[model samples]
Target: MSQTITQETQTPTVPAAHEAPPRGGKLAGRVAFVTGGTRGIGAAISQALARQGATVASGYAGKTERAQDFLHDLQSAWAGHETEFSIHQGNIGNPEDCRRTIAEVIEKHGRLDILVNNAGITRDRVVSKMSDDDWQQVIDVNLSGAFYLSQAALKHMLERGTGRIVNVSSVIGEMGNIGQANYAASKAGLFGLTKTLAREAAFQLARDGKLDDDTIGVTVNAVTPGYVLTEMVQGVPDKVLDKIKGNIPVHRLARPSEIARVVHFLCADESGFITGQVWGVNGGQDM
Candidate 1:
C-alpha cells in the first residue's frame, strides 16, 4: 500500500478514557529506544515510556551532561518500577552510528521492542538563500537518520515478530513553511517511510501466521506535532509565534508531554492495529 500524507489542522479530542493513567504500568516488559531523547519532546517521550514500565535507552548526539541529567530524573521519577535507563551517544545522521547504537542496546537489553525516530535538526533558509550544506544537513539528520536507524532496528523487530516504530514528523511537513524547505521535505519523506514499513510489517506478520481473528500484532505509526514549545522554536520571532498561535484553534503551542502521550499510545500493544497511519497532534493549525 502507498503512504498517504496528512495535513493536520486541529487537535484531536481524545476520549477521557484514553487519557494516560497518572501512575499506570501499561508497558510492563517492553524495551524502547528514543533518538534525540536528551531534551525537548524526545525527553518527554523517554520519560513517558519509562513511567509506563518500559526499559528505555535514549540516544543523544552531543548533550552528554543533559543526557545524564535526563537519565537521573527518570530514575528518580520511576523509583519503584525497576526501569533501566541508559544513554547511547551517537550521531543519528551516521548510518554506522545508528547500527552501533541499536546493536549496543540489544547487547545490553537482550531484545528490542520499540524504536522512536525523534532526532531532527532544522536549517531554515528561503530557497534563494539556502546553501547546499543547509539542505544536506537537514536531510541527513531529519530524514536519512531515521532511515538508517529504522533499517537497523528492523532487523531485530522482524526477527522478534513484534515491535512498534514511531517517527516524529511535523506539521510543516504537511503544510509548507516559508523558510523550511529541507525540513519539510525530510518530514514528508518520513510519512512515506512510516506507511511503507507498516505495510511490510503487516505482510510479514501474516506470513508468520501471527494475525489471527482474535490477535493481530505489530504496528507502525507517525506522530506529527504542531508548533511545540521547545528550544528548537525559541528562535522564532514574537510575531511569528503570534501568527502560529492565531492559526491554531487552541491558540497555544503544544506542550512536549502532549505529543509524548500520543507517542506512548502508538507504541503500546493497544495500538497494534493502528499501523501505516499518521496522527496529527496539531491544535487546529492546519484547519
Candidate 2:
C-alpha cells in the first residue's frame, strides 16, 4: 500500500478546547504601560490591553482630571479582570520625568511588561514661518521623549528578561507632508529608534539563552497611523479634511480602535517572532 497524506491519518491529538476559538489574544497576566495614553488612540490602546486581561498604567502629560477620568472609564470597562488602571503625569519630553514615571509604574504594578510611547505633539508651520521653538518643541516631545521613556522602561524590562515596546509614529514620517516639517522629523526619528532597539533587545535575549523563552523575551516594533480622527486633526478645516479623505483609498480616517488592535497584537505573545517591524495601520493610504 502506498502511504498517503490523509486528514484522518495525519491528524494529531488536540485538546478539547482547541476546537473552540481562543479565549484571548495570548496576553493574559501581563502588565502594560502606555505613555500619552489619556486620550485618542492611546486611550483606545489602553482599553484594548485591559480588556485582554493586562494591568495597564497610562501616562499623561497634562490635565490630571482628564487622565483620572480615562482611568475610571477603563476600570469600569474591564471590571471583571480586577484590572488595575492608573495614571502617571509627566512630560515625556523631559528625561527626569520619564525616569520617574517608569519607576512609579513599576513600583505600583510590581513589573513592566509593555511600554507604548504614544505621547506626541505637532507644531505645524511652513519652514519660512516656523520659529525655532516650534521646531524644537515637536522634536523634544515626539522623538526625544520616546527615547527617554524607552531607556527608563528598558532598565526594568531587560532585568526581567522580557518586555514589549511600541512606538506610535505617523504616516507623514514616511511621506512628508507640507507644513509639518517638525512633526515629520520627530516621527521619522522614532522609526530609527524602533529598529535599533529591536536589534539590541534581540541580541541581549540571544546572549542570555532566553531567545526561545516565551515568558521572558522582548520585542520592539512601531505602528504608523494615517490621518486618525483625533483632536489634532479636528483643527483642520472641513475642506482640508475632505481633501485628505480623498487621498486615502479607504475614503475615511482610521478609528482609534483600529490602531489599538494592532498595538495590542504587537504586545501579545503571539507576536514574539515579529520585531524590528513597522506595521503601518493606514487606511490604505500610500506611505
Candidate 3:
C-alpha cells in the first residue's frame, strides 16, 4: 500500500508597505537637456519630460524672445509646482558649442540625466540640384551635431554610471524619399551612432566594475518619427500633403506629442534594460 502524497502551493511574496517604491513620476529629481527644444517635436519632448518631474534645459538656436516665450508657456502649463526650467542658446553643429551647452546645463542642475538630440534642419533639393552647402549643412546639424552633443554628455553619464541618450531621427532615413538624399543620410547615421554608443557605455561600465544585474547602466537609443504635423510639413501644397497622408497606413499625420511619449518612455528609469534600439513612432508606417 502506497501513501498518498499532498503538495501545497505557495503564495507569491509581496514587499511590505515600507519597502515599496514611492508612487510618483519615475524621473523625479532628474535633469534633462533637449536640443531644438523651443519648437515642434523638441518642444513636445521638453513638456513630456517636464511632466515626469525632470528639470528641463531646452537648447535653442533661435531668437531669445522665442525661447523665453516657450519657457513661460511651459511654466504656465505646469503652474503651482516649483518647476525648474532653463533655456540654452547654442549651435549644435559646432562641437565647442555643444560642449558648452552640456557644461552649462550640468552647472545649473548639478547633474544631467537625459540628453535628447532633437535639433535638425533640411535643405531639400534633388541630389543633382543640391549644392555642397545644402548637403554639408544638413549633415553638420543633423548628424554631426548629434555626435558632438553625445560625445560631450557621455563623459558625465559614464562617470555617473546612469543616463539616457535619445536621438530623434526620421522615417525618411529608414525609407529614402526623392529630393531628400542629404536628410536621409543624416538620419540614418543616427542608427549607427546610437548602437555604437550603447556598446561602448556598457563596456566602460564593466571595465570600471560598475556593471551588475541590479544596476541600471547608461543607455543610448534612436527614435524615428514619420510624417509629423509640424510647421514645415504644413507648408506643403494641399495636393502633396494629401498624397503623403494617403501613403501612410494610418492615413493621418503623427502629432508631436505622440512621438514625445515614446522618447519619454525610453528615458524612464525602468527602461534601463533597453539599449541600442531603434524605436519607430510612425503609426505603422515603417513596420
Clash totals for all candidate models: 4, 0, 0
Q: Which candidate do you rate higher for TM-score, 1 or 3?
A: 3
How far does residue 238 in candidate 3 sit from its true spot (Å)?
3.2
lDDT for model 2, on a 0 to 1 scale? 0.78
lDDT of each: 0.79, 0.78, 0.82
Q: Is candidate 2 or candidate 3 better by TM-score?
A: 3
Best by TM-score: 3
**How do these models rank on TM-score, best leading?**
3, 1, 2
Which stretches in model 2 have alpha-carbon errors above 4 Å? 1-25, 213-216, 231-237
Tens digit of lDDT per residue, candidate 2, span 117-224? 988877777899999999998899899989998898887888888899999988888887778889889888999999999999888778877666546478899998
62-164 per-residue lDDT for model 1 (tens digits) = 8477667767766666555578889899988888999999999999998889999998877777899999999999899888999899888887887777888
Provide TM-scores for the models.
0.89, 0.88, 0.90
Model 3 residue 70 CA deviation in Å: 0.5
Residue 123 displacement (Å), model 2: 0.9
Regarding lDDT, does 2 or 3 come out ahead? 3
